[model samples]
Target: MIVAGSPAAWLDRAGYHRIDSPSFDLSMDSGFILDGEVYPGGDLTIREARALRFVVP
Candidate 1:
């Protein structure tokens, strides 16, 4: 399962120093396809800003 305050915070907290490319892969067998919601550990306003930067455009 993936959990973090935000995408950026997740990356920061997870120690992702650099993202060479703006893409990732998700295996089909991964669980929780539609079973849960992501909760940010910080303030709501800042969460989205931090998270969106990590998403590939």
Candidate 2:
């Protein structure tokens, strides 16, 4: 995985097309700052995402 900046930016700089991933939930690109730097902490599942999407939308 490419590590640089935020997870969202990673996608744009990926310089490729289509990721062979089972699920790429929005939460998969998150984190909690401990001191000052950023961190990755998004780990959502497909089933959970589907449920949330259906209920929310």
Candidate 3:
């Protein structure tokens, strides 16, 4: 789960769960696949951004 947002965005440290995803290993820079969701703690400036940048690990 590669989340790219503003530097001010506070990432939820509560943690997340894992779900069954077939396309998991197909990615390069796959951070952590969360079966659940992440609630942003801070205000995200790029809330309306549609572009997603991923790192192929």
Give the Cα lDDT of each candidate.
0.43, 0.56, 0.40
lDDT, candidate 3, 1-57, per-residue tens: 324432332334534433444332232333443467644333222223457999999
RMSD of each: 14.0, 11.1, 17.3
Best-performing candidate as measured by lDDT: 2
39: Cα error in model 3, Å: 9.2
Per-structure clash totals for the candidates: 0, 1, 6
Candidates 2 and 3 compared: the better one by lDDT is: 2
Q: Where is model 2 more than 4 Å wrong at Cα?
A: 1-29, 42-57
> Candidate 1 regions off by >4 Å?
1-16, 33-57
TM-scores for every predicted model: 0.20, 0.20, 0.16
Residues 1-57 of candidate 2: C-alpha lDDT, one tens digit per residue: 443334566577777444546565556456767589876777644532344334554
* True-vs-predicted CA distance for residue 38, candidate 2, Å: 0.5
**TM-score between candidate 1 and the true structure:** 0.20
Q: Name every residue pair that clashes in candidate 3.
A: 1-32, 28-56, 28-57, 29-55, 29-56, 29-57
